[model samples]
Target: MATTVRRTVLTLPAATVGPPNPLPALRPLDETHSLDERARQGLPRDMARQIGYEPLRTLLPVRVLDGYGRERTPTRLDAIVIENERLRATVLPGLGGRIHSLHHKPAGRELLYRNPVFQPADFALNGAWFSGGIEWNIGATGHTTLSCAPLHAALVPAPDGGEMVRLWEWERLRDLPFQVDLWLPADSDFLHVGVRIRNPHERPAPVYWWSNIAVEEHESTRVIAPADEAWHFGYERSLRRVPVPDFQGADRTYPLRSEYPADYFYDVPAEARKWIASLDEGGRGLVQTSTDILRGRKLFLWGSGRGGRRWQDWLTEPGTTGYAEIQAGLARTQLEHIRLDGGEEFSWLESYGALAADAATVHGDDWSAARAEVGSRLSEALPRAAVDAAYEAWRPYADAEPAETLATGSGWGALEVLREGHKLPGTPFDESTLGEEQAPWRELLRTGVFPEPRRVTPPGPSLVAPHWRDMLETAPADPLAEYHLGVAQWHAGDLAQAVRSWERGLELAPSRWPLLRCLAVADQQGGNAERAAERYAEAFDDLCEERRDDGDSWTAATVALGREAIAALLAVRRTAEARDVWSRLRPSVLERGRFRLIDAQLLLAEGRAAEARAVFDAGFEVADLREGAEILGEVWSALTDEPLPDAYDYRMRPQS
Candidate 1:
């Protein structure tokens, strides 16, 4: 059969990705994986340079999607399927264009770990990331902020004379536009994916891209890569050079051998073909390969430890098999971000398919022979020359405009195009996509003044790009204008100016909780914990009073701010005040796993260890539990003299 693209519906138990947080992300970007001097001693110059160059200060222009809960109802997700005679691929356009499934017809087996349910977790950089399949991670070190967000999807011409589904979006974090084109050639077993990141601005931009593919993990499954050494990064936040296969007295190539979650960025030689694969004892599974430009290959494992097992269950339904990630990127490590010069773009082609080799050779004691065996099989299935030729062939079609629209993403891209007149050839962000969210900014662009809302509602989302900041600097200074200006200034790293702007706005409108919240963040970052706590309390109280009508958006703001206030109060050892703030939270909000976790913390702080222990004994899952977080174990250790329960142990690092 010829390759074809069609729309379809995938029903799964999915939690709603609730409204974004009203507050700006003024805190410093998460630098959890920072390397020590010993860990960085022998790193390549380019890798070190990129690792420190232009790291994000904060997630501005992008809001945190922390409002999602654990309750997952049956949700029908819009999907696009690309199928040929040999394979079928399912893509979810609304959820970061994730490849939800890839099935090989000939083998009658799934090539990737097809997640059974859609459960959002606090894994993405912003929040709300689900597991399994292939995820396109761009923007920065962690998962993309667009993990659960929508992307503009359309049908385009494929290089093989078939229809291709193109997923495009303007990545707000770095101000770059990118597109992912997926197509399957006729009579081929592999699925071809072409990715391009375009820097339309006049200045250089830091670019990060990673294609993360999840493959099933079994006790006998082993990952093969063409490298003798790898940069091992464990949750201990250290990176060290280690020998391949055998590391720390065990064969690390097997995902379950390790006791903690870790990353092994294989140091693929410049002359070697870039490919990575995960195969079971039978030597049958998925293999991913790409053109030369897409250089990095990595193995991310959630090991056989209790914490790892618990995390696996948290991401998907219980009783399902766990999986490990085989990823490819433009840099040698996820910590590094490459530079894309002005008016330039980076494009590459990647292919995913099923691979089968001699099980004895693949699982043999000789690592070199095992790798060579897999490489030979991959060459026979899809040659390196063929991949390069396919990339060259797809280059022309990358510029081909979409023939028809399949779905609509955020209007932020359209707003950017309208403001700057960006001539994006293939990915068009049509003005018709603009909605109420962009209305205020559109008005600001049309007129020189930033219009103030008639009602005393929470401020709309802030724009922190240089151009928007410039416009805000010139706009008439009203309370709303000052509030937004503060955010823009903060994003630009002008803390004093940002504080002044917020203070000025606070003077103009004393009861504006948004301004107070911004100032609270500034105070916290400045190390004025007491002052920050005071501001957070004031902000939460004002928000509660102002949003008494309790609209959905307002309630979100209240809950988010209230959590911050309580945490701040607890930091200062003001347990009573923290309880007060917690009490004001809506009952629905109080019932959330995140709030329940906080309740336990509050109880412990109030000298109620028994009550805190009871909270844990009653059983609750912090639905948004962050990856690598050890708070649950910490609280458990503090409360009792027992080993952490299997269900509660989600630690990803060794215990001290």
Candidate 2:
């Protein structure tokens, strides 16, 4: 059969990845990985240089996606499927271009851990991430801001004279454009993927890319990589070099053997082929390999602990098999971001397929032999030379025009192209993709004035790139202009100017809660918690009064703002006012797990420990719980001198 590409629909019980938060992200960047001097003592010069290099100050130009809840309904997601004689790959273009499934038809087995549900969790850099399958992690050290967002997908000529689905987007964080070209050659068992990240700007940009492939984790499943040592990074915020396979007491290659979530970035030698595989007891499973440019290989394991099991259950339906991630990236570790010089581009070819080796050798006590066995099998299936040849063949076709458009992503890319007149040959961000969100900015670019909406409504999205910010700075001063300009200033680290801009906007539009909320964030960041609380209270009240229709978007904004208001009030020991803010929240908002946690905190603040304890006993899950948050344990300890329940024990690190 000839390789083919087609559009399809995947129906699943999915939670709505709701509207983005109206408020700009003013807080400092959430850094999840940290290494002390001792931990970094023996790191290589390049690795050390990339670590903490050009980290994002804030997630600006991107709004927080916290509107999603736990309630899931049957949803039909748009998907693109590429298939060959032996394998079929399903890509979800709308959800970060995730490869939802990779099935090996020859063996009637799935090569990837296909997620059964499309549940959005608060795990991405901008929130709203779902687990399973192969996710393209770009932007920073964390999951891409586009995790729950869409990518422009279209059909293009493949290197093997067939059609390939091209997924492209302009990553706002680093102001870089990237494309993922997925194709399968006829008569091939492996699914081929070509990735290219282009730095069109005049300045060097820090680039991060990790192809995270999740595979089923079973008791006998073991991950094999061609490395003897690895940098072990656990949730304790520490990194240390350790021997692979057998690390600590048990063999770390077995995901189920560990007690907590951890990442083992394998230190593959410079000359070794970059590959990793997770195989079951029968030595039949998925193997991922890439050209030498994609140098990093990692194993992310959610171990067999209560917290790990609970997390697995939270990401998917309960009773489903858990999974582990085998990742590849440009750097040696995810904490590092390599530099992409101006006008230069980085491209790599990756292949994923099933591998079956001698079970005894794969599960042998000798780690080197096991790795060598898998490597030999991979070499026989798809040689490193073949991958390099494929990459070379695909390079010319990367510039081929798309034959058909399948889906559209954000308009930010198109807006950027329009502003700079970038001649992106293959991955064109056409003007037609620009929607209401980019209308004002597009008009501002064409005309000298940023148009202000006639009605009193929540402001549209803000753009913080230098060009957009420059245009906003020179545009006519209106309430909306001032609000967006302040956001740009804040993102650029001009705190004083940002605060002033918001204050000016507040004066012009007294009832605009968005401006007031921006001021509140500034106050909180400046350590004026009381003033921040006051601003938050005022903002929530104004939002409630202005948006009385109880629309979904307005309700979402109200709930998000009200939660912040209540928290701020409680922080200053204003229990009555906090309760007042809580009462204003709709029943649906108050019933959410996050709000319920806030309710417990409010109760504890009001000297009602028993009631706070009851809130926990009633059992609610904070669906968007942060990766390393200790709030559940802290609240449990505060309420009583009892051990934290296993259900709520999501602590990834060991307690001191």
lDDT of each: 0.91, 0.89
TM-score of each model, paired residue for residue: 0.98, 0.98
- Misplaced by over 4 Å in model 1 are 28-31, 36-39
Model 2, span 1-656: residue lDDT tens: 99988899999999998888876777744557666556666778777878858878899888888888788899999999898889999999999999999999989999889889988876788888999999999999889999998999999998878898899999988989999999899988888899999999899999999999999999999999999999999998778889988977999999999999999999999999999999999999999999999999999999988888888888998989899999999998999989999999999999999999989999999998999999999999999999999889998999999999999998889988988888888999998989988998889999978888766667778889888889888998888899999999999999999999988888888567999899998998899999999999998888988985777678878877888888888888888999999988889778889989998998999899999999999999887787677899999999988889988988787889
User: Model 2 reaches what TM-score against the true structure?
Assistant: 0.98
In candidate 2 the C-alpha lDDT for residue 411 amounts to 86
Q: In model 2, which range of ten residues has the least summed lDDT?
A: 28-37
Question: Residue-wise lDDT of candidate 1 within 313-377, one digit each (tens)?
Answer: 98988999999999999999999899999999999999999999999999999999999999999
- Per-residue lDDT, model 1, residue 250, is 99
Could you tell me how far off, in angstroms, the CA of residue 300 lies in candidate 2 after the best superposition? Answer: 0.3
Angstrom error of the Cα, residue 370, model 2: value is 1.0
Stretches of candidate 2 off by over 4 Å are 28-31, 34-42
Candidate 1 structure lDDT:
0.91
RMSD of each: 1.3, 1.4
> Model 2: how far is 166 from its true place, Å?
0.7
